[model samples]
Target: MPNRTAVHSELYSPDSADNPSLNGGRCRSCGYVFFPPQRYGCESCGAPPEKLEAVQLGGRGTLHSYATVHLHMGRDIEAPFTIGLIVLDDGPAISSTLANRTDEGLAIGDRMKSVLVTASTDQAGNEMVELRFAKAEGSK
Candidate 1:
């Protein structure tokens, strides 16, 4: 059993605590892919709600954009993190935290891969895992 649970059941794939893939929705009608597994109709083409199908991303993406965080923003999360917008191989761009936060070491077009990381802890002290993008080895 996974120690972590996605807000929605279809949000993650291989549905395990270890190295689960991000489950995105692809619009069969308009080819729009979304990270939240689009249960709603496509806003672009007004495709019927059911047109969205769940697809497992390859877990690899190219860094399209990024922002370095400096404030905690009243959240439980820490500061000095990197938030990246990555274009996945499967055609959807998703936002995730980067394992490496330093701007000096990160660059646009760098290859990133999804990996399980701790989001926080539960009242029971169990870790909550979430997907994060990290610099792939040999990918500068």
Candidate 2:
């Protein structure tokens, strides 16, 4: 068994065999996966919304692209952070605000893994958990 502290938050969906990903949607018609869940329909095939289903996404992927944020959005949002798209092995590109990781010395196509991070705090003094990507430990 894995030894770790469990965080209580809604950053992702409950871990279930049916829907493992907290924020992933898959099109039953076209097999296209989406991050942030497809509530309307398939973006690629324009299928009926009913054809979309929720899914649990794997934690590993390759860095498809990225950009550095120079401007600040809010005090909760840190500047000089990197944001990027990761191509998951399950066939979806997930956008994440990279945290505790650097864009330096890395390139597109490098292996990366998803991580849960405490991005900020809520008004109630609660930690806001977020999913971010970092270079896979074994990757260059």
Please give the lDDT score for candidate 2. 0.71
Model 2 agreement with the true structure over 1-140: per-residue lDDT tens digits: 22222153333732332222445788999888887675788998999999998787777789999988888779866687889888887777878777544578778998877776655555666554556677888886
The per-residue C-alpha lDDT of model 2 at residue 10 equals 34
Q: What is the C-alpha RMSD of each candidate to the true structure, in Å?
A: 2.6, 5.1
TM-score of each: 0.82, 0.75
Which 10-residue window of candidate 2 scores lowest in summed lDDT?
Answer: 1-10
For model 1, the run of ten residues with the poorest summed lDDT: 1-10
lDDT: which candidate is best? Answer: 1
lDDT of 1: 0.75
Best by TM-score: 1
